[model samples]
Target: MSFSASSPVSFVRAAVDGEIARFLDRRRAQLLEVGSELVPVADALEAMLAGGKRLRPAFCYWGWRGAGGADVAGIHAAAASLEFLQACALIHDDVIDNSDTRRGLPATHKRLESLHAASGWTGSAEAFGRGAAILIGDLCLAWSEDLYQASGLGPEALQTGRVPFDAMRTEVMAGQYLDMLEQVREDGGVEATLRVMHYKAAKYTVQRPLHLGAALAGRYDDLAPVYTDYGLPLGVAFQLRDDILGVFGDPEQTGKPAGDDLREGKRTLIVAETLERTGSADRAEFLRHLGDPLLSAETVEWMRGAAEDCGALAACERRIDDYVAQATAALETGRIDATARSALADLVVAATARKH
Candidate 1:
């Protein structure tokens, strides 16, 4: 039942992709049978599920293996369910951030907006797009639940998985609201921003996946604390890396414009640090241009240099390394099988080492 670092990554990817395709195919037929009018919505859902790297599913699979679960079918289904949840989140996230692209394709909202405009649909194109995207996101959420219910886990496993899923969804929604609130609040300082990052990105992205995987393996009592020990620090590192890539990664690889995070005014730890360390003039300039969607490449380069010059990037790197070390140390404390532990450790490295 154990997997090597190299094999697990590939196996997890294949399993998740297969499960997602199967789920989508079945759901597409069901939606079509419901009515012709729901076709676009179904297509949007499928598109949103397309072309993801499936990292969340990998995390779930490895976590289950680490907890000594041997049922590949059960683990695959659970992992696929996580992907569905992720699709729901991403679709809504793009709408909230007003992002135009995902995975190098038009975002759900943008695609819907384009269709509305081209078809000369009655009502404002923007409103129609947002409404359609919202419905698509909701559909994904419903399918997420349905898929999880059909994961073929026993009743006992379902009881365990439900706890983390419920908490994860609730906390993520709250985190999303908090994120929006932070962008507008005059008094939202560095602390507030960090809190939002923990709730919105860290816990939901890494911690919850680990918890769900462990729950599926019926090792919640033994592995829940391990999630805190390993997931929290790793989750933070993951987001810090994401923030770095959002501002600096190649647009082709990241599937978004450079400085997109800056344009969205994401209240990341790096941004908070930059705000704290920069001088008054530079700080004023940064604040003025922080969320301006019209930012040029030159301005983004300047902001990047400013972040490095003010020690924000260096500090963020140090923090990432610290978390990586913490996760490594926690792995030593865990009593999982050596092979499973090795796979999870490799995952920690892979997740944190990515450039995009």
Candidate 2:
């Protein structure tokens, strides 16, 4: 649907979508010359990009605008580049999480697995699926860089943005490793949870995107700290909302099966708080099925009950509320464009409080 009529953010979202679609169409045509078999990679990438709130681009666009950058086609393309980066992260994340679906459709790896099974491929469908997904994720990462470079900014401006762009990729990879380590160890409490959120979600999702936009507009030195002040809290709040949705949100809205995070044994603040507050029996029950792939719906509901009974859900909600307050406060910092500030205030709410 055309989101241009909804709001300023929606206009940015629609513009970003248009840029991404054009980029993918161009890429798909180029891939066709390689081989028909290669077309599925583009298809997977296209499908993955089709459904998202475009929040990263929205943040980037507003960041640029807040930095006194003109509203221009170049900034839109630059902002849209975050979508490709996000695609890379999502494809790789789904593989690592063993997620079956994303954006309410089979994940890239899962889709490939089904394709292999349907075609009666000669090898293990699981392995083939994973391998294909890895390559596709890499392709998206590479394309993200290309689009960033070609965002129509001058060489110096692109170079300015490159600093955060490079750092973001590195930080996200490290964050993913830390996340895996948390799953394996399964004992980090609130501190660990916040650290993971900082790298994995906060910086990568919001701060860096904002920095990239500001940098491209030649305002990095002045605005980087301000963006961080605004972006980090909002970003963490965004992920916390995601964690809540992973447990409590409807499948129709969240685009994942119920309790998928619980199935994955994510060491979220919710899990940590529940463990801290529950009685021994309730804690044991939660731990018993914390990471079980075979957890029944009844067990999932039971865990949800235990979380609520122990006040973990309420605690998480309180934290989100505080972070939202902090984020909204940060936007009032000196010298930001008034229009951008207002839109960003709206974004703080939209990012932190949502069904999906």
Tens-place lDDT per residue, model 2, 86-143, is 9999999999989888988999999999889998989899999999999999998999
Q: Between which residue pairs do clashes occur in model 1? A: none
Lowest-sum lDDT 10-residue window in model 1: 1-10
TM-score of each: 0.95, 0.97
Candidate 1 wrong stretches, greater than 4 Å: 1-7
| Best candidate, lDDT | 2
* Local distance difference test scores for all models: 0.83, 0.88
lDDT of 2 at 223: 90
